[model samples]
Target: MSGRAADRWAETRAPSLAEIEALADAAFAALPEEFRTLCAGVRIHVDDFPDEETLTEMGCESEFDLLGLFRGVGLAQSGEVVSGQMPNAVWLYRRPLLDYWAEHDETLGHLVTHVLVHEIGHHFGLSDDDMAGIEAAADDITPSEA
Candidate 1:
């Protein structure tokens, strides 16, 4: 294929980072207020792929191995904020999410929300069952029909 055609093909196949971030934001907004309050101080970020340091820390052999990651103290363990301490953050890796989306029938927004909730759920010290229930409840209220 010609270079121009190849570039166009790549652009058409991949979701932009801005698109992913918007989806994540919408998904997060759909969550229950109780859950959102729990995630008040959390920051969500999106990247095309996981960095090398992240892969090593997560014990993954490849960047695509991790779709999302939660870093920082859980609500149950975090005491009063100490000086210079970093706040909690949840990272959503776009490349892995796109890979998963390509293989599954689910919408990208839903997938992003799911990963975001799962990670933030950890911050709240919620169990897997609790997170699942929260996800279901959130899905029921999602306005976009995605």
Candidate 2:
């Protein structure tokens, strides 16, 4: 195995929900200021697996079908805030994310960032092409650049 691969195997354990949440937070913070500014008031939640209702609602064959989900009115569709509107939120599935990481060649932080950007893209009413550009822009930002 490569040095990096060996390093990962040194202490094999799934990242806890809190750890995933931290990764999401770091990923969001690393995004460009313009992108982050548009995501104001969004909340993030991390769970092991999506609930049964969400599974059926999303028409998924398995819990692993979804890595993340966005629930709320898109920015473009928002008119006026009601008296008691549920805040827009993003839900990240920890087990599904970990499973995808094990099967892919990317780092966990990168994956979390990708999902975060994608969900936020939906909020901004952006097309897939636009989101791809944003992801590319994000990929260009190294830790030093961030």
C-alpha RMSD for every candidate: 4.9, 2.7
TM-score of each: 0.86, 0.88
lDDT of 1 by residue, 1-146 (tens): 99998887686746688888888888898899988886878889999988899899889988899999888888868635668888889989999999998999987778887899899887878889998998988889887632
lDDT of each: 0.85, 0.87
Best by TM-score: 2
Clashes of 2: 0
Model 2 stretches astray by more than 4 angstroms: 2-8, 144-146
Which residue pairs in model 1 clash with each other? none
Show the lowest summed lDDT stretch of 10 residues, model 2.
137-146
- Candidate 1 C-alpha error for residue 97, in Å: 0.2
lDDT (Cα, tens digit) per residue for candidate 2, span 1-146 = 99988887797777899999998987888788898888888899999999999999999999999999998888878734567888889999999999999999888888998998898888888888988877777777735211
